[model samples]
Target: MPVQATSVRAPFDMPGILVPDFRHSRRFQITEFGARPGDKQSTSIAIARAIRAANAAGSGSVIVPAGIWLSGKIHLESNVNLHLARGAILRFSDDPQDYLPPVQTSWEGIECFNYSPLIYAFDCENVAITGPGRIEPVLDRWKIWSARPKLHMDALVALYDMAYRNVPVADRQMAIGQNNLRPHLIQFNRCRNVLVEDISIRGSPFWTLHPLLCRDVTIRRVSIQAHGHNNDGVDPEMSQNVLIEDCVFDQGDDAVSVKSGRDMDAWRLATPCRNVVVRNCRVLNGHQLMAVGSELSGGIENIWVDDCHFVGDGRGGDDHAVPINNLLYVKTNERRGGYVRNVHMSRVTATTLAGSVLAVETDVLYQWRTLLPTYVRRLTAIERLRVSDVHVQQAQSVAVIKGERDLPIQDVRLSRVRVERVSGTPTIVENARDVTLPAAVGRNGASALGADFKNSRRI
Candidate 1:
């Protein structure tokens, strides 16, 4: 039977999120199904068999014992928990053929049929991946696949065109050719009451962990270290009532990126990503601590970030750290018609920042500008952003807001934010309204703002 774990309370005032608890569940060992260490094919087959056994027996855990086991794609079933014992290392196959037969997955923000994620769950309930083992991809093949040549760009163009025309999703397949749209490390698509806890994940082909269109997710005490291109630590896309806490993220991109769908597909779905809380997390290196959309056309609301910090020296050491950039970034373009509201951040600290503390840009389409013409001119409405009790030792700038003339960003407030030193201008504003940076929040506890800026021009 599927379990609906009770909602867990959050420190904030929002609704509690549900998480699966599988304490007394029956355990099905993979070794019993003839799994052998270091054999990818056998281990993969054994894992599938064990999952079937566990699911058929009501609810149970499919246990992977301590060893170096190699496997292919793992498709989670309903009412099943895939647990790994201590000292267990599950390495995934590097060959592309292991992920054949395209699955319903998304790339960036566009939905299409692509290679299955290394671990995937579609339309399942009460699923969890727990325990203190390591799950990683072999980077040998993925490192080369990361580069997007003309073939990949052409595939992206086709995907965008399909979305624009409202083509059936079943017909849009990109896994047939050398498109090279890499799959995510783990994806739980349309699954409810999901829990991912105590696992260490390293080396991703794309975005590391994604919870898409799911409800009531709890990700706790996990560690991620993936420096590959587009390797965001966690992306909660079009999901609701999520709580991510007590995690350590050393990422190539943002630590937590909250996104909705993109453009036309988003408009059709009209499901906003809302009610997400990220707390008590640490970032070693990333583009930003948190980023909200260049893909937010379905709208986003009610996000809270609390007690997060950036650690590690900016100098790239033997660990190949990339250094932290901005504390928070909200990016969008004219082609996306969405709204971002009620975003709050508090108790954040950083040793050094390569960019501004907060940045909002209205024009942030990387390659889409020239690749495709804007079929529709739609703007994103961003408002009601608050930051408080943030202290940074050094930064390039305090804040930067660049909004379009027609639809400017509004109602941004900063309080008790102290930066010891800045290399560039303390604040830069363009086409924004009601930006209140109080005199109390500044460099060395001095006034950085002379007065409240309303409908300000570029400075």
Candidate 2:
């Protein structure tokens, strides 16, 4: 059973909830700075100054008055509150360069190449971004990133080199087109005790909002979407305690993804993103409703995902046709060894394309570098996971659990899992060990010789 915020925790059960408590805090409005409503530049400057002032003022909020305040990347300070007035808009500028050079941030748990997000916070304690307003990004930020010719091999090489080298992300010249490649609109790294509530965010170039490597965070009653490449909503990575409740996601990719890190940096961190609960959220136009790791470096444990409606576009096409590719996706990009444990998901309903309910994959980039034990040990594996009382409809297989020989998944159980396929049967399990299921869940799809374990499962 899921652990309640007010209840005690059991050994095998999820830990108690971790919703942030923001009942007490001082508020500072942006209007006092004399910036007119809808003038993005002046208002942004004022907000930045206000954040600094609030920090200097000893823990108070910097409120955004009811209007549009256009901006680029704005750094957040500790103990500062960013409150949005009831009808205000905190719009992000579209020019990619406005985001500036790349910052050292966690992308799936490891330091990587990408632009800083529109609203960012790190190393802050007891923070909150609350409002009943909108955060709309200027799409032009992505336009610059997409202008690069895709066939340019030289450009590709340069990018790969950047991602490879532990490059200092400061004061570097970046290709504008590449920023569009990143989907993070709002991101927080290494923060503690934060609350994000009652905001409507939209139009992302990359992942919508990422809360990476943070602890004790809460996101409630918010509507956020960015229907573009990898525009995932609320990726809580490598963090300890998290609660994401009563939110709605209409995105291009996964709605909510839990991650640690990626490859070596993630394994080295060894920080399992654990004790998470995502309940009563609504997902629309997302491929995976709730996901875990295409890049899980540290690992994930003790999670609960329940009572979510996953709806799709019935008009039928790859774009909007999928409510879920994965209701629960364990995508292990572990270049280092790690373990995923104690996950419980219940009452998740989905409308789908050709995908799975539960996907356990290990595409560890398993090359020669991945063969060594210490190197191979960094690979990701799933242990002791359970899914019960799931009702999946609108035609697809029931579930798929698979892995590689280097990192085989074990001790998986599924009870009362039902599937209604529109075109064909959806149950497929390959290369998994000790897998258990309720009688008569999915009744289609050919069984692999357990050889599909070695089959590739990459994004």
Clashes of each: 0, 18
Candidate 1 residue-wise lDDT, 13-111, digit = tens: 677666676888899999999899989999999999999888898888999999999999999998899998998889998888999788999988888
TM-score of each: 0.96, 0.84
For each candidate, what is the lDDT?
A: 0.87, 0.68
lDDT of 1 at 113: 93
Model 1 CA lDDT for position 372: 89
The digit string of per-residue lDDT tens for model 2 on 284-370 reads 767777787766657788888888877656332235433457788777654545668888888888766457677776663432232
Measured by lDDT, the strongest candidate is 1
Q: After superposition, how far is residue 31 of candidate 1 from its true place, in Å?
A: 0.4
Instruction: Please identify model 1 stretches exceeding 4 Å from their true place.
Output: 1-13, 315-319, 440-447, 450-454, 457-459
Point out the worst 10-residue segment of candidate 2 by lDDT.
450-459
lDDT score, candidate 2, position 166: 44
Q: Output the worst ten-in-a-row residue range by lDDT, candidate 1.
A: 450-459
Which residue pairs in model 1 clash with each other? none
